[model samples]
Target: MELNSAKPGLLCSLEASQSQRTMYPYVTGTSVVALKYKDGILMAADMGGSYGSTLRYKSVERMKPIGKHCLIGASGEISDFQEVLRYLDELTLNDKMCDDGNSLGPKEIHSYLTRVMYNRRNKFDPLWNSLVLGGVKNGQTYLGMVTMIGVNFEDNHIATGFGNHLARPILRDEWREDLSFEDGVKLLEKCMRVLLYRDRSAVNKLQIANITEEGVTISQPYSLRTFWGFSAFINPTPGAQ
Candidate 1:
């Protein structure tokens, strides 16, 4: 997979500020969380794109299924994530053309993505996104993550960006290897809710994807239920904007 240049107009900088240094992301998404359940893998991400402190885009689809079995959830530059999808789609097509019974699963896709990220980093131009790859094949489930710098790892549960900061602690305390599908979705929803409440780049609307031996299932966009009745939310300091 090759890294593409950031999309024109993807960044929300003033025209006067445009320069080589401005090629990096100015609008970005937040966290993505994925975990393994007894049946397979489940992932979730909010639909938000933030430009600096401004909420820029809504209804952006950050989680998508790759080929038939693998699903990917991405956070960071929305343009970079879209570019990564194009690369992965081509890779999967070539693999399909090989006519081999075996295809790239979650593990293989994760490896390919990490190499792409690392290669781009070596060129001093990274993809500017973090990804969660999840899938199940031959009764084995895989859940892994990779960052812009190419750091990669697998866990029963994994999250990127703010999720790494706010969600992983809850996962560490509550995640289980043999979690049921219901429990897994509940856990992910819990994580997403926390992110929506605490992460400024996060939104209440989210999409969840699941991959089992049967194949991939991506849910329609939805919003999480929230309560903002806390004292701090109800009352701010005098003269506070």
Candidate 2:
């Protein structure tokens, strides 16, 4: 039998596939929480990204804006979320060129993401993330979530990854149709506290954001402290026994 020579097209195809595979990483983030309030929306996520069983990072920001008006809180595949945010930025900028000359609103951005997730699902290569979209829609504040496979749903509150398991219940208990912005912020802090206690992947260092018709406001990181504990030993063990 005679051997067939390698074709340039086949080599090019293989190289292209290998390059894509190499570019994608397996790091994943966890625990994103979001809720809608009377004024707007509040969202938060912990700062941990885990690679398998190892905790890989402690300062990842999982909350960001899509365009100027929409906020997204994401869990899973930090790099993928960054790419999606970039895509959203470009998409919104492109939409500004329409005859209407308007950037993508929150609902429009959510629809775009749904399509992107579905298209990736059809390709059997997914973004491997869950995202919360929060902002104003039709003069009203809106909160919604998109799953890895493109399922999108609206809710008074939403949680993803570890937060779904540990923080959602606490949110559900306090969530109300009439919750004010201050109440929403307090609720989100409480939710983070619950996750910090229950979810091993979560910590006291939290990133919280609020989006409204006015704009987005993110809180600075603050320590969750204990008033009484072993820390009393800093100066001297108080009756060490």
What is the C-alpha lDDT profile of model 2 across 184-209, one tens digit per residue? 87888887776776566775677789
Q: Candidate 1 on 20-96: residue-level lDDT in tens?
A: 42256878888999998889999998888898779988988889889878999888888888889999989999999
**Range of the 10 consecutive residues with the lowest summed lDDT in candidate 1:** 1-10
| RMSD of candidates 1 onward, in order | 7.0, 6.2
Q: What is the TM-score of each candidate against the true structure?
A: 0.87, 0.82
Give the range of the ten consecutive residues with the poorest summed lDDT in model 2: 225-234
lDDT of 1 at 200: 84
Top candidate, metric lDDT: 1
Candidate 2 residue runs with Cα over 4 Å from true position: 1-25, 99-101, 226-241
Candidate 1's displacement at residue 96, Å, is 1.0
Cα lDDT computed for each candidate against the true fold: 0.88, 0.79
